[model samples]
Target: MQLVALVPAHDEQDRIVATLAGLYRQTRRPDRVVVLADNCTDATAEIAERCGAEVFVPVANRDKKAGALNQALEPLLTELADDALVLVQDADTVLAPDFVRTAAVALDDPEVGAVGGVFYGEQGGGPLGLLQRMEYQRYAHEIHRRGNEAVVLTGTGTLFRASVLREVRAARRAGLLGGGTGCYSLASLTEDDEITKAVKTLGHRTVSPDGCRLVTEVMTSVPALWHQRMRWQRGALENLRDYGRTPVTAYYFRQQFLLGLGTLALACFVLFAVLNLSVNGWQGAAPFWTAITLIFVVERAVTVRGAGPRAVLLAALLVPELLYDMFRQAVYVKSLIDLALRRQEHWYAT
Candidate 1:
């Protein structure tokens, strides 16, 4: 397979070199590296060129990341041969040595349209950074249990079969899919999810394999994480809205809708628990309180344990997990509300 790595970057001078360097040292190096230096005033394009990548700066769709990616990929994806695979990497993320090899292997089945990597958290920022590491490990472990079936393809280290991308492009042209974002669906903030659904719509599979691994930076602060997740949850909601009961995406749509309802129920339960405690003090709510404690035990022992001893200890500590859950729930509620209101788009640096 001819592997072509596509990186869409905007003002990423501070970190693009590390990304390129990692690609250069890959176990299965790409045949070519294509960088979309979108609206950069800095040395992003220059740096990418120096690293031996063919750079393209697209004029249209410069406002959103999905747009930039679509602008860069539009003509190329439709024309590349089926044996060619396109690997899309976020500018801030770094790949493991064997990432391309692993992804290439997964696509050997021919029916698999896309493959994504398991990501570890980037090391050493602070306590919050440690938490992010733990969070990613736990999440990755959960997804790993899912085997090859994936609801969404991560952008960090995703490889796409050129044939499937051509199918997606044709779908967009025939008006079978939304055209606002071009091939990548710029209308929704989470274009990755939209593209995943579109790929599935074409009777192809998207897989996540353990061997295809990478490292990603996490949001360092509570506010940063909140905004990031809010956009993600909203994007999930938007994808569901856009693709409603369409055959290929009906399962994910129902899943997210039910998840929203379940989340809303969780919020109500929390309110009721607080009210019960307020009305009858700690003694009457002991069982409820105890159940909450057991949740921490399960979370630590079953979930975050993979992150290592520190994560196991922290999950038992419960404070961080509880605080993070509160923030996540708030994000879900806010995202749902905003989507309900049809609020304007919000963008942030990756």
Candidate 2:
């Protein structure tokens, strides 16, 4: 039951030490900690080395995070036993002290192939950050509601069995999966989502236990949040396209369709509201809709209560969060349009 941690970093000098330190603080520390420093121009590698982590810098890896991970995992998977666990965590996230211990317990079940962390946003982005924090708290609520079944193996932090990863690689090579020969799909923009599909397709369950938690970086501004979500939404659509209507992708397809409907519903609501205001003057709200809105507000407030007083306050504000939801709905629509038009996606820093 050997445990190894691989942190994929690209110019993360500022956050590298803290991330590594979090790993060291784990209740169940990794037997080996390797930092995959991909094309780093900063002091990321040196800093990681100073913190006593083995740094594996990929040679001319242009495929982004997926490529860097494949390069490092190749040797490690080959060297480690089938039962050995490998944790692929983002360099910017800080895991809870019990993250490793809890995730390991979950993976102890042979049927569970991977364990993902329940993540919340780190502080300091002002209003936007608080919104993201509230959103993450809701996500955490959903995970709990679903009994820890992983909808997606988030890249923020996920633990995997070396055997399952090798199986994923073999599945790709044998044409059972679409990610080329590597464990991660080089062509997919959202490698995490694609890998979740791959794992489920292999008949393995993914879980996100409550004790396995982390605090991840959030978008600081509207532009950053927009770009980040665009990539996420678009990448998800593309992965669904690549996988096509299988049992593995059925839920994802439904999710996308619902997202589109949600967007359309919001747009229609705004349009009809303006039309009514111009034509009929300020008519009072209907009781049914008011009740519905109340229910929604209550749900929002309750879901974000774990995020503390400030988050609860924001969730209670209603309009601000509604505006945020409208913005996300727009991203969903834009992502669909971009995918339909076959527009190129440009990755940018948030």
Candidate 3:
């Protein structure tokens, strides 16, 4: 079966070379590699061309990745057959030598429409970088353990059948995907989630393979992580509106419910502290909350074995983790508001 690797890049000169080098290392090389350089002020296109990829520079637009991907696919579809597999990869991710081969074999099954590989964090930057690495490693471990039970959330290292993509494109043309009236809109951010749901709606399965793997860089700073999470939360909220009332909508609702519970728990704890300060003393309820917080820390520590003892201990300290949770909740609330306002999502390099 013929395969194409599509890499969406924008101002990624620093990371593009390594990504291409990894692609070159793939055991089963794709028939073609297409790089969508979207509004890049840098030499991303030139660099991609130097790396031997067919580069396409798209017109600047609000839809960002989705727009660039749609434009890139137009020419690819004309050149390739409808049954070809298209592997969508981010510019920051590096695949294993056998990643493409594994994905191709997995998708050979008629029932599997899409497949994603395991994502791990690369190390050797600094303390903040190490923290981010540990966080991602923990997340990857959970996702890996969950296997195919976990929802296919992102497109960082994912492969899709061209037939499935055509169905998604047809739905987009009919205004059945995304939130806005147009076929493609800047208001929708999590296009991967939307497409995965669409594939499932068409009775195709999406899975994460056990052998396929990819390494990705994570945000090194807290502020960067916050912004990235904010965009994801906002995009997820926007995608929820499109799914509407379907049984598959439970995934979105489950995330919202968990966030709501977290928010309510924090609020109740604050109220209890305030009441205690007014009635009894400063020491009141502190120990109880501390114990409760320790429980969460312990759970996280047990859940993330790759974090090492030191990182797990740090997580147990609860000073920064609690603050992180608070920040996440705030981001979630703001993203919901942004979605409600129908504001355009500005894609930023994470």
User: Residue by residue across 1-350, what tens digits does model 1's lDDT show?
Assistant: 68888998889988899899889989999998998898888999998998899998988655567777777777887567877989999888899888888889888987888997777888776677778888788778877887756667887779898888777877888888884636687677888888998899888988888877788877777677777887788888888888887888777767777777877787787899799889987774468868987886876766876667777887787778767666677787788778779886487664
On residues 212-275, what C-alpha lDDT tens digit does candidate 3 reach at each position? 7888887778778777887778767767776775777786688788987988799788799789
Error of 2 at 31 (Å): 0.6
Q: Supply candidate 3's per-residue lDDT for 117.
A: 72
Model 1 residue 189 CA deviation (Å) reads: 1.2
* Tens-digit lDDT string for candidate 2 (222-257): 988999999898899999999899998998899888
Question: In terms of lDDT, which candidate is strongest?
Answer: 2
TM, every model: 0.91, 0.98, 0.86
Model 3, which residues run further than 4 Å from truth?
60-62, 124-131, 178-187, 274-296, 340-345
Candidate 1 clashing pairs, residues 3+ apart or interchain: 181-186
What is the Cα-based lDDT of residue 282 in candidate 3? Answer: 72
The Cα local distance difference test for each model comes to: 0.81, 0.92, 0.76
| Ordered list by lDDT, greatest first | 2, 1, 3
